[model samples]
Target chain A: MAKAVAPRGFARERVLEAALALFAEHGVNGTSLQMIADRLGVSKAAVYYQFHSKEEIVLAVIQPVFDDMARLVRIAEAMSTPEAQQEVAVNGMVDFTVRHRRVTAVFHGDPAIDTLVNSRADLSDIIERLTVMLLGTDPDVTTRIVISVLASGMYGSATDPKLSDIDDGDLHQVLLDCCQRLMRTRGAIGDLRTRGAIGI
Target chain B: MAKAVAPRGFARERVLEAALALFAEHGVNGTSLQMIADRLGVSKAAVYYQFHSKEEIVLAVIQPVFDDMARLVRIAEAMSTPEAQQEVAVNGMVDFTVRHRRVTAVFHGDPAIDTLVNSRADLSDIIERLTVMLLGTDPDVTTRIVISVLASGMYGSATDPKLSDIDDGDLHQVLLDCCQRLMRTRGAIGDLRTRGAIGI
Candidate 1:
């Protein structure tokens, strides 16, 4: 994103909002800068003045999420117990995914991580930190697979044919239930749920 | 597939194998008939002579999996208990997925499922039947999400960056363990595992 002497937050928000809508409909790769400009009823130069490239627009749109996770990582790291850290990590991921369910579905449902966002080591590093906080370091092969499936499924669930129709709050609970089941860690909240419990 | 009077299975196999290889590298949509011919070291005419279109080639390539599931569905339907049927379904999927891990990755890993194979009712029907077998009738929303995550994860795990490197046997066991855990069903094998047990 280009920074102006007086950053027009209003113009930037419009561009980002228009770009997100277009991305949701046509996918990140399919949406063009021209289309975004057209959607905004603005000239290409006007949009260009805000964002140099389409990727920058996407980055700016998703920048809040990166910031959110960075803050979460800090909070989780400050905690002492693995269980507490994991709760924070898992809770943050589930809440964010649920809060922005539609957006997450659009981006992840795209076949390949478009070269648009591909090879971003910083994003991956944050995700990795959150993952370790959730599963702890040096987890066994089973834990890796379990968490991998849950993570993959959680992202895809928003766009899933059957799950899509369900309410977001219900979706969040079930996903957390799944994560807890697969991880099989009782932790402090184990008192609330019966052992081996599977419910909505 | 063209019904050659001779029904030359040998030539057909060569075409299908070449098409599969091309599809793996360049997704179903990216792989053209000509590319498959080039891979097979045959003329495009030869490839067209074997299958009427690229979709036909993909259909032929995945035909065996459909047949395998159909047969599995029959066996599971005959089982008396839901648990028995679920085991039959789960075991069949795991074994088939592990047995054909590379192919599964190539096809399922492709986004949009390729218009090459999209909107195929017969494939969806078979998958639905298999899902019903595994999930039983009228499962709760929680069960649906848990199984949804597991099933989605199972298909995608073959190509998942972290899980991809795992040995097939270990992957199979862990996936089954995850499924059984989320299902929370002791079934006939509860005795085999300790209560609420999760292991690789």
Candidate 2:
């Protein structure tokens, strides 16, 4: 049994935090509820009171990130122009990813998380809306490729242990700039740069 | 029992191809030697004859991709200038990823694969060399971030089922262009364009 720490805030929140840390270190399949309870310094019964199953806990852990994604989609959808939509969506995503790096890292390569995320109709709709907003209506292969690439970059860099030495503030800005460069068409590059969308 | 098809090259090679396809459809954990044998229309003993365990099968499946990566690293190292090195490394990576999208896709969200890949000292050294080649000698955070982002994009887009309708040639060119765009410094953008490095 691992040493326990005092529970913080809500019992639910503490369980999630403890689970996220364990999941990050040991992976989802490797983690057990007992470990989460041990980390929380609570009884296994206490942990079960908050969530019935490991899957439920997994869902709860990811819920906030999904909520943030949906919120960002809503905000981006209200923007009138594609450029504004793209800017808002990209910026929001980067901010969310940076803020939740640890949680996201835990979910990053886990297939169980992928299945759970894909099964949610609401999340799918949000992702579709976000995708359209980023690439506009009738996105071609080029647009899709560029957007996916930028996403990969943002997520990979944020979670990369190799980049631990870099400050989050600096990392965020550079990631944003790189994404903008990838997103912009050759013709729009000059205009976007002039509009101060490419960099801080 | 799967319907036996004529062996193409060697029994070992045939088993690997069949296993790769099955593994891609069902995850490594979800797949078994019995299934591979069934796919090959052979007995489980035959499958075992080719490879003793699933781990060995996985290694054989990934061996080609790793070989290609090593080859690319050597090619990039031979280049005289940093610019040349970056271009060669990026182009090679995109090409390799696109070519082996199926095998890569199977490996994509699997943690077991991650552990296996990371544990290999040779593979790690190859990846390190490839990263250094792409980012040059003394890469800043921005360079590292950009390289990682482009990488994410290439792999993600190449393996995405949603983009299946898009022709490989078109996807390849677009991916290369996006990678080049992410890689070039603002000052070098003009020079790279003039040199026709940004497109096919």
Candidate 3:
């Protein structure tokens, strides 16, 4: 049973990796099965054997990120306090986003991916769960907006060409620092206001 | 000369407004001149008379936003200090983004908009200028990333469905509060660390 599953799993992984690269470069609309097959140095039929359609391949490519997100949700859930859960969840998300920068870029800018993710109940459920964990039970508009900013800001910076010169460790540290600053719950805006950080 | 330009300008403005609505609903790639014309109840030729191509319409559609950004740069530049400039820039940007939520949504997610904006040096230059105004002369990765989060966060939240129930005034105040918290320049990360806001 192990042997039977291993080869299929290996092939599927290869297909997804190739498809992701193609999707990143040419976009989902521009990429075709033939190009993916060519990149893999395999026949179209072999590609079809693994994934029936381009949509399926796209779904497969995104599945691992969702899996990681699910794992993050589980880790956060095990934490004792709400604060602990928020910390674990935010750090886990930042690490996942940075580690998968290429995949994140594809997901970030692609309309096809947006439609697919939004339409899929499973994906949206995971996102809703992540949001709940991040914002807590009684989050206000400020908290929701700040959380959204923290996320997209991380994604945007990670994929920025200007910051490509910086090493990954430095980038990761900087992102975490900025995210933590944005994620501060108590007296953050008031402190900034008191210090005249924002002009009236 | 005024007579010649007035009618053309009015027609051009109508064409752009119609085009923006179609682009928002159908996407830039999915939109066409005929659709813009159909929406405006004008002939395709009349639309073409105002703007030669779909690309021209897109450029025209975005020009007002760029004009607002230019106005923001001027406002920031007139401020007395870098800190003042940062405050004004962040606040103005948040206001602009929230006020123009529909157009921001189109710009935020559309690949066609991305390609067009990136290709045009004028648009990118405005963005660079805005970044400089927000971050000052020499910003580290953290500052840059945080500024990005503030901007995209405002954009994301302004268009959020859950936040739709929020009135414009309430949404604006919440966004401002959140942005100010994220935009603190001096010892931001250090403050977070000292407060134990970030575990690391």
Candidate 4:
């Protein structure tokens, strides 16, 4: 079955994209292998040829987004100043989230997917590093809590109908503004600039 | 089956509490009427006596939270001043969310629940009223957008494990501070305070 599968270099990517759309509409549990296969106009065996199981397909879909998030955090970590790192990381994360809002929603809104995200040590590790980077040194318990809340807000808020019309660019700016206010301290603006991000 | 139910008051509350716990752990799809009954140490017949179906149980659990949030917004709407109302509304919401995070989590996390929440006009009306109250009259797109982001942040931020340890009092303060930063303009703030909330 594997040998007979299409040789397209982007087979995995194609499957993931299709899976995300179907997962979003019908949910991870509500969706099935056959539905995804039908959506792709491929047979069940073709779908199976690409992915070993639904779990593997789901992980494949979620991995790219988390990988993108992890990459942004890594870049922000490379920045010399804490403030700049925070700004760039915050903006990058928000923008990435907006870009992949539906995928993120499918992940967040589905308990099975959520369980998978939380249970995967690799994913959790990436999230932990991002949290540490965001929290910085000497973060009080309160700041830790606020940052956590802000992250969820970014993910969950995008799906809210009241906020539906607000486009990505504006949401990015608004989130940055909120983050700045939450983390504001003396020299914060200068620190942000040093990392190549400007604060208005 | 319908005739075997308990008094409407006790049966409704008992069924809701059991359903919420089960839903939180097993998810809506993972959970069943039998499971809820077992968890509550009751018979399947007893469960059916209380709730006709899983949908009814879910509706019973979700609507109350929406109603409570609506009540909060209504109280905020009655205030003559934005400062007082903002302070009260923000604190109330944070407290409400923290106290009922599990229910909120189920409400936010489950796609089935979210779909149901979206389709329920009664619930949507309350949420819309709350959003409009936050946005105020003549709200420019920016104010509306920021409020929407903040609202999303509020619910999203609550369940994050990173923010899990934050004490309720501290979280409440942080949310209030974030709210102030989000509603930055005087005219917007003024309109938000003066804007009348429509009753459902």
Error of 3 at A103 (Å): 1.6
Q: Write the per-residue lDDT of candidate 3 for residues B4-112, one digit (tens) a residue.
A: 9999998887887788788878889999999988998989999988888999888877777888998998899899999899899989988788777777867776779
| Candidate 1 structure lDDT | 0.74
Tens digits of per-residue lDDT for model 1 on A74-162?
99999999879977787788778787776676667465344444468888788778878977887656667777777776776655767
Candidate 4 residues B1-200, lDDT tens each? 55555466777788788888888787797899989889888899988877789998898787667777888988988988866666667666777887777788777656688788788898877767766566565675556656666667777767665566765655555666665655563334344334323311
- TM per candidate comes to 0.78, 0.82, 0.80, 0.74
For model 4 the local lDDT of residue B197 reads 32
* DockQ each: 0.28, 0.35, 0.34, 0.29
Candidate No. with top DockQ? 2
The 10-residue segment of model 4 chain B with minimum total lDDT is: B191-200
Please give, for residues B116-198, the per-residue lDDT of candidate 2 as tens digits. 88999987889889988987888755676677677776787787777777666666767777877777634433443454444
In angstroms, the error of model 3 at B161 is 4.2
Q: Candidates 3 and 4: which is better by TM-score? A: 3
Ranking by TM-score: 2, 3, 1, 4
| Candidate 4, pairs of clashing residues | A149-B157, A153-B153
Instruction: Tell me the tens digit of each residue's lDDT in model 1 across B99-131.
Output: 777667666746535444458887888877898
In candidate 4, stretches whose alpha carbon ends up further than 4 angstroms from where it belongs are A1-7, A10-13, A48-52, A79-85, A115-122, A137-139, A159-166, A185-200, B1-16, B45-67, B79-92, B112-122, B137-140, B161-164, B185-200
Using TM-score as the measure, which candidate wins? 2
- At residue A190, give the lDDT of candidate 4: 42
The Cα error of candidate 2 at residue B130, in Å, is: 1.7
TM-scores of chain B alone in all candidate structures, in the order given = 0.77, 0.82, 0.83, 0.72
Q: What TM-score would candidate 3 get against the native? A: 0.80
